[model samples]
Target: GDVCVNTLKQDWSPTHGIRHILMVIRCLLIEPFPESALNEEASRLLMEDFEEYARRAKLMTSIHAASASSASKKKATPLSVDVANHLVASSPKSSKKEK
Candidate 1:
């Protein structure tokens, strides 16, 4: 995924490459491929039916924004639970090591 982002930054050096890259990125954002995916499912959805894909993308974006806002409200300060757990588990053990 990071490599793909880097690839997008590079010059396409070919006609219509920019357009194709944009299409692919759009697909990746909505329907990410964590595994080895030849092409993203979102792109196929878009190519098959643009209208439906756009509608769903818009809805998802709105829902994501709302959830982000909700989460932001719940977080009031620093020192997360993960940090506390790490500090507790990472202490030295007072035990002799056996060879």
Candidate 2:
């Protein structure tokens, strides 16, 4: 079950706080509900070949982890003041006059 679509949106309640939400997410990860799966192919693979599914999941996790580490190492350069000002000035909202 999807956290956003199933839990947060559909099964959302005042009683279900952050802790409850987290627990639900944890449960889903531990034991996935294939019936309401967003990715049918993954669900099918998981159902058909558990070993293959596990292997692919591990591979994807490692790939993502490597990319994430590399991304963290690269610092984002801040936009120059001149470019920021130009962007603001060029916006459609900036062109509109309020009478």
Question: What TM-scores do the predictions have?
Answer: 0.31, 0.58
Q: Which regions of candidate 2 fall more than 4 Å away from where they truly are?
A: 1-5, 66-99
Model 2, TM vs. native: 0.58
lDDT of 2 by residue, 1-99 (tens): 244347767777876655566678889888888777788878898999989888998998886665766878996644322332331224555546878
Stretches of model 1 off by over 4 angstroms after superposition: 1-3, 6-39, 66-99
Q: Clashes in model 2: which pairs?
A: none
RMSD per candidate (Å) reads: 15.1, 12.7
Residue-level lDDT for 6 in candidate 1: 31
Best-performing candidate as measured by lDDT? 2
Q: What TM-score number comes out for model 1?
A: 0.31
